[model samples]
Target chain A: MALVFLVLFVAFLLVLLGRRKPALVVGLIGLLFAALMFRYHLTDQVRLSL
Target chain B: MQLLNAVAAMVLYSVVLGAFWFQFGDSELPCPLCLLIRIGMLATAFGLTLNAFWEPRPLHYGIALLGAVLGAAISLRQVALHVVPGTGSFGGAVFGFHLYTWALIVFSVMILAIGAVICFQRQFEAQQSPAPSLVRFAGRFVVILGLLLCLANVIAVTAECGVTGCPDNPTGYLIS
Candidate 1:
């Protein structure tokens, strides 16, 4: 999942260099990937801290 | 504004480099949460990259806002884990704060900064021209640099995690 973010971010840059719209698409993908990763981390690594 | 955006990107890249220094120099492999922080930070930086080179729009800054918010949440989670007595902490401390704590601070600043910047209506003027040559040059350099660093991160994570998920407490690269 983290790799997905990294790869999408790099793709964001790669597409970002030449175009804007596709780069935005890539950015959205990054956000989606981050969200999924965040969700997984929260649930899988759930720990009670006081 | 474009130049300033580029400078902001530079600051972010510097922080990532610092993380790299700790990962490679101090030989402390990043835990799972740590990698997420980097991902969030990079996503936020991506927004700045757009603002520096392309048209500065509310949408661009929105990306920064969302990234910061997400990053802040992750950082807070990490902080909570180590806040309790005897829970201990991950990695080493810099300037007396763990990296996750620093990440929280950085994300806080990014949220405020992005919120403040997005309010300037003049930046969204439809008649705006392309960025100056210097800004364009800087943008290209930053993007290229980011690509290289991100490639490095991909390789590093692969070596560290292998085919399985990353370990919670990583002391050495799994592939090694």
Candidate 2:
């Protein structure tokens, strides 16, 4: 799951770089990855506690 | 823009060093894998500062490539430590992936992107010779100072880590 988000984030970065729209695209992709990772990590914690 | 980049690089390096100190003083001691990540961060910070100032494209590319290599190794080790517990030691298992992994990945990506930009910018600058002397001088100064700061932080962190023994918590709940 984390790997999936990592690949997507890297692809988005490559696209932004190719298109010369790095700032916006990179920022959005970074945020998306962070959100996904946060969700996954929190879920792990909740599961462990339960 | 160069100054901003240099400052950001410096701040990030300082934060990493501070984290190391906090870990030694408060939390559990860092394992070999954690130390590798710290080394990678230090290298990336150094490269970023150098890339910000150095107009020569090749030099920037070299620095960035070095940083990327270090980052890739550390990130891979970090992932492996989490996924394949037995591959590393108890210390490695204790110090699993955290926010530091994300920071390492971001640092690597930033280095690669900046390297590409430097290559493109170099070509543009070549067409317009006689670049501003002050800008070049300032960039050189920043690069030198940034390298020195990075070296100092790396030394401090390495010495501190060496002085402490790895702490273990069988329950894996304790902060230390």
Candidate 3:
């Protein structure tokens, strides 16, 4: 989850610096991270049963 | 202008850093929703950092607004979960406010501030020229710190959760 934010932050920085292509790539990666996190959270699969 | 934005970044980072300290100092592990809220705050700070670096466009504010709204939604959901009488919160309180409540306040303020900036565009417009070297230096410095903090968080979360992922009520690290 934190990695997702890191990638997203980097994408934002790239966009601000006018590096369009890289920003787009990083943004997509961040979205992917967010999606995975959302899926795991929703499914309740990540938490231990304990 | 750049100086102001850099200061904002510092303040924003400080808040997040404080949260991290509290989490570790109090020996509390964050749930998924808590992580999301932190991401939201980072996104808010990213928006402000953009303002310092580039021209003011609707896109920049849009990113911040989206993050803020998402974060607020998660915070609210958590509040709803615990709002029922006799429901216990996950962590200890800070100044009588839980972390999620503070998150709610921050997200709400960021939304309003971004909305206001969008409405009063001229007042917050960026300068035409490239930022001065000093301004650029300050901006980059703070951004670098943000990047480092994010990286640190990634490492810490990975260490805590491992491949299986964090338990809902994480008392200690799962792997070890």
| Residue B45 lDDT (model 1) | 79
Best candidate, lDDT: 1
Measured against the true chain A, the candidates' chain A TM-scores are: 0.60, 0.43, 0.77
Error of 3 at B38 (Å): 1.0
Q: For this target, which candidate reaches the highest DockQ against the unseen true structure?
A: 1
lDDT of 2 by residue, B1-176 (tens): 45544555565566455555656565545544454455445444444544445434454345445655655655654564455456643331214535446556666676666665565554424434544666555555544544454344344433443333322222222222
In Å, residue B33's CA in model 1 sits off its true spot by 0.5
Candidate 1 — number of clashing residue pairs?
0
The CAPRI category of model 1 is medium
Ranking of predictions according to TM-score: 1, 3, 2
Q: Across residues B1-176, which tens digit of lDDT does each residue of candidate 3 receive?
A: 45665676676678789778877887778887777667767766666666555545566566667667777877886776687789988677879988888889878877886676578657356466766788877767766776777777777777777655556666776544
lDDT of 1 by residue, A1-50 (tens): 54665755566576445888778777878888877877776665475547
User: How does each model score on lDDT?
Assistant: 0.80, 0.45, 0.69
Predicted structure with the largest TM-score when compared to the true one: 1
Return the DockQ of model 2: 0.02
Which residue pairs in candidate 3 have backbone atoms (N, alpha carbon, C) closer than 3 angstroms, thus clashing? none
Q: Each model's TM-score, in the order given? A: 0.92, 0.49, 0.81
Superposed on all Cα atoms, the candidates' RMSDs to the truth, in angstroms, are 2.2, 13.8, 4.9
